[model samples]
Target: MIRMIVKDLRINPLRTGLTALSMFIGIVALIAGVLVGTLGRDYLEAVNARLSGRTPTYSAIIDVTSVAGMQTTMTLQERLAHFEPGSASAQYHLNDLAIWASSGDGGLEIRHVAVTVTDAERTRVMPAPIIEGAWLTAADKPATLETVVNENARQYVHDGTITLARTGNPQQVPARVNGVIVDGADEPVIYVNAAALQRYWPQAWTPDGLTILVHPDAGVDDRHAKTALDDLLADVGAGSVSSWNRSDNADEYEQVIDFLQLGVIVTAMLLLAVSAIGMINIGLAGIEQRSHELLIRRALGATRASIAAQVIGSSVLLSLIIALAAVLISASLVWMVPWMMPADSPLEPPAYPYTAAMIAAGASVATSLIGSLAPAIKAIRLQPALALR
Candidate 1:
């Protein structure tokens, strides 16, 4: 029976080609969609891994104001001396410095950016790993009263660099373009020294912003930390107190990526169904065209069982050939594509799932068998006498 099927394939090359091509297209679609889904997942996962590196440093915001009749100078030096940050907090942080730009067509705008603590301090606590650039150093401080912006933040304003000045003044402070930084959030961020930051004009200013380095002390619960912070603020006799997770932005970006992934899966399934329909149609047409040949075989004493076996066996062989063709084409493309991408793009282990490929092959086999049934049944119903004539 297999020999007969092979002979028929050689004799009727056109029909064989049509069936194989139809399935090959469907298999290709299935593979491409799945690979793209895997790529998206990898991109997100890599981003997450880096962000996890930044979480321990617990970056937060604080804005404090002076009460009437304090009778004291509120210089940043005095402020840091006044209150000792816990071991978990950064001792010093950029306070009021921000990147100024148009808020997308608005006349003028500012992004609230701070230079993170020291390079070591930021690396310890960011919600994501820093990809490039160092924290603004003490020397990045004002011999000329300039700033160094964070890397990722540059994407929002300029390609690689941006300028900052007092919002309304003609004065422009030149910040030499430094390398970019990336945490998981992928935001438009900038960084500069706290003292250098004082030169920039901003809507608000405070000496009490706490970038604390909390201790590894086991007894410090959130409640304990909050009470301690409150006591610390009161004892220092200044500064509003608060602690915020640094990775909030990264979390939001990850959620958006996850939502997009779900959408791709839903859409891929629908598109795959469409392609499968095309394959099924081609298979059924092939069977229909072979009806007269089937009738001839019946006249030659072909059993109903043999005829059914021939039909099913032929379908599986054709599906396997198509699967092979699709696999070959996609594999070649994957090998070539990595070379064409930018060098800076993150390296990812692209997915080629054996289970998914098997499932797709099984589906193809099922589709082929289902496509044979109606024609096989019709062939069986005909009497040999009627069919032979």
Candidate 2:
């Protein structure tokens, strides 16, 4: 039966090819739809991953004001415990100072280094990518003054230390560089435990802001979390605090992804439906043109069942060919597309979904079968003697 169907398709190559091409187009549309849906979700996942690398989980850095009367570690802890239940907290200060760096010419080069005084949450939430050594932990300080410097600070750090000295005051503190981190900055930056920095340089240090790590499924989202934090700060006369707005952005991003998915699916469905209708038309025309041949076979003792099967089998063969072509085209295009994209583009090229290809193939064959059913039945019901005339 398969050999006979193959022979028939081979005999009318042009007609068969054109009908298969229609289904092939539908398969392409289906593949594209799957890519669009998959890519949308993949894009979101990539964005979330990038953001997660930069930002800490359930963490927010808030602005503190003088009206808050210099937030102390003890005070912030009490406020967090009272309002934001089931949450963790930390404090950080972003400061800057001019440090004397070795210029490699044996001359001193003045480099401006950004300093951050952070609690354990610094490592927890916004953990920088560690390139060398280990990250700073709560236990890292008190025993020795340790600092994690960014890659930009490598030049200034000699003998595992850097000198911090102002113009008039010759007093210098040589901080031991514990680790090197990738902070995505062009300038030298250093992170140290807040208590250690303040304890050493009482006059140079000041509390800047607070960081809070919210827990997962903690019965609180960003808005509610922010509101709770704000209310707590306000009650303590902290005025207003600034946050990264991660929650708001995440919600908006998800909505956009959903919209893209819906559009792709609807468009693909329409294209597939049109293709199915076209295949049915082609099937009916083929049956009519081959009526004489079919009747001759029937008169030679072929059963109605065999005649119907032959017609349906031919449709299935055409669809299989179409599916093969679609797979080749889609795979090639998907593979080569990333090379054509710009280097710094935001959307990462998506991995081709093999499962989606199978679905497309299945849908195309099913449509082909349905399209050929009526034509097959019509051919079966025809009077063999009359058709043979």
Candidate 3:
């Protein structure tokens, strides 16, 4: 039976090629489905690790927010008069203000610039980067007075043991700039102890400049946070309270990935269906052409089950080859694709992803199985008496 199937295949290379092509396509789809899903999760994990590395500023930890109004039609002096020193809290429109402060060896400079947190870490800044002298720990130690400066800031600002203070004309408290290092996306930032920031400006904490922090051991609970924030700065008002959660963003990303994965599965199933059709056509056609050979086998006393097995086995052999080729091709594609290339990328071509390649192999088997269905059914339908004639 095996020898007969081989001879039959040799007799029709065209049919075999067509069968292989259909199976290959199905295998590729399956491989692609797995690669995209796995890689998407991996890419996100990489980004999170980088952003959450060692020390996360408020920006990475939070999202976009601001004071309520800016067109107050008042000068700086007018705004100052509104600063109710004794007042416990104040609230303003969330979309209205820039919140920034600078620490130099000379003193503190409050930029009050509009900025958003790009990324963050729960306790560890991600990507495990190098720090200048000391590391940021949750210890109650005074925030590192020795500062690390951003590469960009270092250009205009003095380096190597300099004093920090406000740069703009208005008077502000002075802080020391102890050291400097590259900030990455975490750059354009000034680091200061929460207490130090509060002490430095003495006046700015007014219902404004609210810094969001993690709840120790409890994790991020928005309701708990809202309550605590309100209690600490009650006069700041509910309007002043705003919340940001990394977990929330992560959840959203998960949902998108889940949707994409489902799409991939559906697509793979459809491709497999197409392959099944191709297999059935090829198998049945092959069986029809070999009716004489089958009759000879039956006349020679081969059992019906054996004939059936012979037909199915031929399809499996073709499928195995198809699966191999498809998997290799799919894996190669994945290896070549970068998870996060630059906006304007400049990199060499990639290689095949081994894991993805393995996944493609299974798709190959599935493709063959679908294609074999028709041939198997036809083999069973054969009339031994008609064939013997």
Candidate 4:
């Protein structure tokens, strides 16, 4: 039956080739749309993660105006002092202080840079792509405080030392620039170790805001983690303490991606439908042209089911070949995405989306089956007596 189907397809090469070509185009479009949508969504997710930290990250603002606020802030600091690593409340905390510092290269001009005083765990909570050097570590703490600067700061700052001093204090300290990172910040920013900053200039170590990130392996949900964090800082005598989760901001971006993917799927489906229509038309015409041949097969003891199988099998085989080719092309395109992106972009291209390829293959097979139905039915209905006529 397979040999007979192959022979019949080869007899009308132009018609078969045209039908296969149309279906092939549709499969390629479907695969491309899925690949683009999946990759685009992943890129957005990575950008969001870099800017706002990973999901479930909670940020709290401590109000320091009132007397109670001052006491609460002091209490929070006291609690942080006794923090033990690997405890039940093993949450990672990050704090930042905005300070004015002068560079030897800048001479008389002092630059305002945000100094993020955090531990090595900062990367696990809020990941920033390292551009030149490495992230902060315990070993980075020395007499000359090692700091990582963002891309904006690297414009004026080199891999050397910068002077840090309070606005009115005559005392100055030197901080070494160890590396550069992309933190998605518009202004100049520097990251330093909390212990090093506190040792050199305790006054400049005061945090303007606090960010608490719950560890994924901490075995606690967001609600419980937020409650634990609030309880930990409850001693802050501030007028009001407000907190928000990163997921709140991430939802908006996710909705936009969902809409885009929906549109792509719909468009791809339309293209497949058009291709299916072309296949159905060509299949029916081919059956009509080979009516006498089918009648001869019927006379040679071929059952209706066998004749129908031959027609449908030809379409399924052609579509399977097209689907495989389309998947290979789409995979190659996905692999080349990183090379196409700008060097400054922090978004890392994700791996090829195998789910999209599977979907495309399924759609191809279903479309072929649907398109071949009419031709299969027509082929089976032809009487054996027609061969004698």
Cα lDDT of model 3 by residue, 276-348, tens digit: 8777877778878878777777777888788777777777777787777776666555664666554222222
Give the residue spans of candidate 1 off by over 4 A. 41-92, 96-114, 120-246, 249-259, 346-349
TM-score, each model?
0.58, 0.60, 0.53, 0.77
Please give, for residues 289-342, the per-residue lDDT of candidate 1 as tens digits.
777777788899989988877766776778877777777778788777777754
Q: Per-residue lDDT for 1-389 in model 4, tens only?
A: 78976776788889888988887789888877877787778677767767766654555444444322334433443454343321111121233233444447855544556766655666665678887867765523343466788888876463376566555556666777778888788888777765556555666655554444443334556556555555665544432346544432577687899898999989998998998999999999999998998899899999999999999999998888888887888788778888898765766766777887788789889999999999999999998998998
Candidate 3 Cα misplacement greater than 4 A, ranges: 1-8, 42-248, 292-301, 332-367, 383-389
* Tens digit per residue, CA lDDT, model 2, 177-204: 7788765566777777555555566555
Lowest summed lDDT across 10 adjacent residues in model 4 is found at 85-94
Q: How close is candidate 3 to the true structure, as a TM-score?
A: 0.53
* Model 4 quality (TM-score): 0.77
Q: What is residue 232's positional error in candidate 4, in angstroms?
A: 4.9
Give the Cα error of residue 57 in candidate 2, in Å.
5.8
TM-score of 2: 0.60
